[model samples]
Target chain A: MASNDLLKGMLKPIILKLLLENGKMYGYEITQLVKEISGGEIELTFGALYPILHKLEVEGIVKTESEVINNRNRIYYSITQKGNSKAKEKIAEFEEMVKTLKVFFKPNFGLKYEFIG
Target chain B: MNSLDSKHIRLIEADVENARITINNLSQELVDHICCEVENLMSSGKSFEEAYTIIKEQAGIKVLQQIQENTLYLIDKKYKTMKSTMKITGNVSLALIAIGTALKIFHYPGASIALLLGFVTLCFVFFPAAIYLNYTYKKDQKKPMLNLSILIGGIAFMIGVLFKLMHWPGASLLLFVGWSIILGIFLPILLFFKLKEAETGKERSIYVLGVIGLITFEVSTMFKVFHWPGAGPLMILGGVLLIAVFLPLFASMKFKKGTFTMPQFIFLITTSMYAVVLTFLLAMNVSDVVMDRFVRDEANSTKIANYFKNKKTVAANDSTIKVSTELAERTDNIAKLIFDTKIYLITNVEGVSESVAMKYVSDPDLINNKSNYDIINHLLEGENNAGLINSLKKELNEFKDKAISVSTDPALTKSIQELLNTSDKQMGIGGATWEELNFRNTMIISAMAQLSEIEKNVRLVATIVK
Candidate 1:
């Protein structure tokens, strides 16, 4: 599970990337998805989440829609065109960073043979 | 299962609610993350109470405190920004006031509009903004600055109303009274609070001095309105108080804080300049009125002279023959002199000539003058010429009677009578011509010249005549 600090920094990009892939999600649904993806090891906080959503709304990167579902009202957010493009760029950058980190952890061929025996 | 242990569930609910409200200051996403973590823990083997407490502990008190502190910091930052904006607005308002005052002094067409805009900016926009900013600053501290601003604004409005009521030239008294009222009324009030908050004796003394000075000035102005003998000196003293005492005190106050505002400078400049200009104009207008009265008297004398000359020529010739070349030439010369004198009089008078002329002619000595030649010479001699024309008419009538009695030649007697009658008729026509041609021309030319001078001085069209 990612630490709260790590998650705080990555939250916006992760949310953007998720919205870009899944198209739209409500507040409760987004929290549920993050928990499920992290195998119940990670969580999102409502206090931190709503302000970001509001800020994104103000910045025109995200837009909200309200609908009545199963007798309860919910607000859903979707990535704008600009947000979508930014999401793709950030995901690519994150992937590249992960790829570079893999090289340091990979074992040498000789050391691997000795350890295996 | 003992109804799912309602007490335990209730305790968990209370904790969750407390966390939600307090954590709301943090980002919505963080709260959502904490909520999801607690929900997941509850879904696992842990009870709801255990899950909530565990997640809350893991989140740590330091993170929540940081979030709270960050929110407070942002609020403070926003407040500071608003304060700067208010200060800037106040400066702009004062600038507009200065520009409006300049425009009005120069008599620009849109000066009234400029003044109205300036007042609106000061009273409605900038002052309120300043008060709001001060309110925000003292939200958790002292409360004097906001109250002071409001008091100053009210005093300013009253001064504005007085300005309109008095309609005094140059707006000097208005500005002085306005500034004084603000300083006098608000200084003590602000000082009272300031002393309570800061316990500074220096600030209190400065405020006390300001109030004393302003009250003295205000009382003096009221005395002036009552036409008291000591009013002028009192006004001067008040002006000195403002410049020497209050202004320096305000400056020192600003220096202590290492901050200076443009409004303070503007108020100083505006008040002093208004004093100088108003004093100058008042002195100028009074002298002009006195000088104009003297010039108009001279013009009336010239008019009387011209009147007598026309009468003399008419009484002499009647209708028999055109006034002899000698008399015509003499009359023309007198007429010309009278014409020149009238022009000189009108030029000197500038404005209020007609009233002055009317006042001049009302004297019996001037009104009795009827003969053109006698009146001209009498005016030239600087003596009474009022009855000259009437005397000349009587003299000419007596001469006609003597000619009728002594002449043996009937034809000669008849021709002389005819000449006398023609002269009288021609005199009427000639006098009318002189008035229309010479006097009217002098008036028109002098009026235009005076208008040009006013335009040059005030940058405005003189609406005095036209």
Candidate 2:
């Protein structure tokens, strides 16, 4: 659950990146894609996902349309041009942050030191 | 399997029912999500009971409840934002009221409509919006102070409306009392609680003192309206109370906080000043108008005496020397008394112009004093050793001629003619003395000249007295 907090920060960029590539997705479809990508380890609640989707819609970063699928009305959301640009920038920043952190995790090649009194 | 399907259907119905209760208690969005998950599971080859249980476990009851609360919180946040906008609108309306009030006071032609609109906004719009906001936020329960404000605002509105419609004396005092209660007592108290609740009590004591000042103002106004003594002292005491209690409290608060808002200082200073100014003006204006009426009456009597002196011959009756003498002496004494009283009043009272004082003395129709014709007739008949009937007659003719010269000015002429005509009618022919007949005839001529003046000037006099 605590690890999910770190993942949650990247979820919008990930979803936005996916939508920019795929064009549009429904709520259930987005959840499935996220689960498949994480090998079913990460689960996103519809309650959490819907609000962000609605907020993005309200902020003009996303647009939605409803269509009848299998006798149910499924709402599909697509990233706007603004959302695509934001996703691109966020992904670049994420990659930069990962590269920066990679240096700290590497072993240092310094001479061994004896314990001092 | 058929039995299983029936059992599943029953469970599904029960789940839907339970979800309805949850929706009522929690957020509809969460229930809808749970319902969707249950439906999805049922479609994926699970029995209804199994699907319901599975979905219920997937979203832990506690997490579901928390999510529900969060959703409600979000909705409430949106509602609060909308309400705040409405409140801003209400405040704008209140500001418009103040602007309208200012325009009205400056003598704008449409000031009456503005005043009406201002009162309407205060009563119907701003006050009710405050109440509605308090209710919507559920602040009415958590903050009893808000309720107090609403109550005070409603009462003040009612009293304000009543004050406007009625011409009751001391209405302004009522208005002042109402203002003090709302702005001073209720608002300050509410603000105090708000500050205290926010843990910002540095200026709480100062606000409390402001409230005390307001209460004192209210009490003083009450005293003034009821005509109770010590009203002045009470008002002074109230002013002192504000300075003594509020000023020190304000200083201490400022020392502690190192800052205060501009509005806080403005409200404090303006309220104190308003209290003092209003109380003083009310006391002065109301008392002065009442006192002035008495002085005006006295001056009017003296003027009536002078008019009588100018037209004495026209009023003289020659029924007998003894009767005429007594009447002339009585009229003379009354005239002297009126004139002396007017002089004394003018000397004593401030704002009583000598001309205005003299106007009261010079008013020709003061029924208590003898008319101008009476004085003239007295002199003509040689009453009280006032000799020379011919001289009195000439003087009467001269005054008549002067009156006639202006009589061409329609208003003056019409007024004079009306006076003469009324007097002539009153002086009938039967049992009248020769002097009375001549006086009535002269008055008739004077009236004709005055009517000619009115016709020339194109003015009308509805009533005239000689």
Candidate 3:
């Protein structure tokens, strides 16, 4: 519900960026940080976040460590040494794409429809 | 910040369990995440119940299960391809079958081709892909034998349907196995699962009602396909249960709860479309089966008459041959005219060419045209109409005279006269002419059989004279 599926594709890099900056964060903390940083424009539902986190874990881009808090276990995700570089690469790649996409937003509109090629 | 105690943690865990989060890592993450969310909300003066309700809205069971499905799908490339294949072939077959059925009802050409392509796509591509994807889904969920019976039953049923449409052998075996597995094994397993999963009394009743209705409808489909008795009562019962009892109750409940989702919408359309098309294609009613028997009778008479012709050729003397020559030619003329009429009926009715019509009627069991009496009547009947049947009738009366003159024996001459009679006298209560009595109410296939029978009798009378 956070991004209405538009920000959904960008979540993987966002999570990796958050993990790189925080060094170590639990699931709830990551979500709250995202909401706060995006000025409540983004809400990371645990449903979407955990799958990406688990996939990152499986891919060795991030790793998990568990601690028993209250009656259940809290899993903390942190970027690995390899993930540190991968996170920067993914974030830069996304930033470059977005910067280039801005060109389309200000394009001369409907100028070509008259040609009828 | 207030933290959750053991009791609050158990409550969160119970809700997570209700989502069927079977994966250990995913389950742990969800319970802990909800607990953290609830605690943070509690710190802001919200009660535990209020916070939990807010969390459940975002992470409902449907969302949680979808995450698990997506994660599993992401991990396997082959599964993704098969899943896409399942979707593509299913839709393609649906499109082809819809087009095919429309064409068939309108008596257009290419109906058989479209239907064949549709059935082939369904039986070979979609069913296999669907089974593989379902198996992969069950494996990922760690639910053993979850969709086994339904998958097997569906594949068998679809393949059996394909075979039956093409009039291929071994369809009965496949249909029997398919129906047995669905009715005997899958329905019972489904019933047990529904009972175990449904929580409330209303939910249980609805589930049981749905299963009973589906089973009864499927049973009637089975009975109708196999031409067994009791299909009518069962069909009516199933229709009442589904339409009167089940749909009203079920749809009302869903409307009240506002729980209808996109998948349910697709499922409703696809399932009903499939049932309608299957019942229409698979019924193989009484008239069609009787038509096959007439085709067989025509074939038998032709074979016997050919045997007599071969014998007559070997045994004939010069004088006898000369005497019966006119009779033979007239018989051959009428026979050729009748064969042309049969082909004309098929080509016009099916919108196919002469060559294609030949191919269609060459296989007796596979003939589907020649059933429309109204169009045939329009084509072949009227007072003083110069249709092929009238010309053939005129040719027959002349041939009857030829047969009577050519024969040496008086008894044989009388029998040939009776056999070749096309008189206008009323044979029954009807005030109809000889043409109307024979071809008006009768199917084209039955008429064709009678024409061939006349040809056979002509050949026999000629052979006896020789």
Write one digit per residue (lDDT tens) for candidate 1, span A1-117.
Answer: 678886776777667767887888877677678778878777776545565665666567877776644322346789887766766777788778768868756868457878888
Recovered native contacts, candidate 2: 0.04
TM-score of chain B taken alone, every candidate: 0.35, 0.37, 0.60
> Candidate 3's error at B138, in angstroms?
4.2
Question: Which pairs clash in the backbone of model 3?
Answer: none
DockQ of candidate 2, scored on C-alphas against the true complex (2 decimals): 0.04
Span of 10 residues, lowest total lDDT, candidate 3 chain B: B306-315
Tens-digit lDDT track of model 3 for A1-117: 454668778999999988888898998899899989998888887767877887888788998888887768988999998878888999999989888788656655455566764
Model 3: residues with Cα > 4 Å off, grouped in runs: A1-10, A41-48, A81-85, A88-117, B1-24, B31-57, B99-114, B138-146, B198-209, B247-365, B369-466
Q: How much lDDT does each candidate structure score?
A: 0.50, 0.51, 0.74
Candidate fnat values, all: 0.02, 0.04, 0.70
lDDT of 2 by residue, B1-466 (tens): 1123344444433433332223222233344355566667777788766877787666644455455444444445655565565567667656766676565434355545555565666666556665755554432456665576656655564555445433234555556666666765576667667467434455555566676775676677666655566666677677677766677676566545423445657776688667677776666554443344346446544544443434333322343344434434433443343344344333222123566556534441111111124343443345553434333333333333444443224544443443323222244455654345433323212222222332222111111122
Error of 1 at B173 (Å): 14
Q: What's the ranking of the predictions by TM-score, best on top?
A: 3, 2, 1
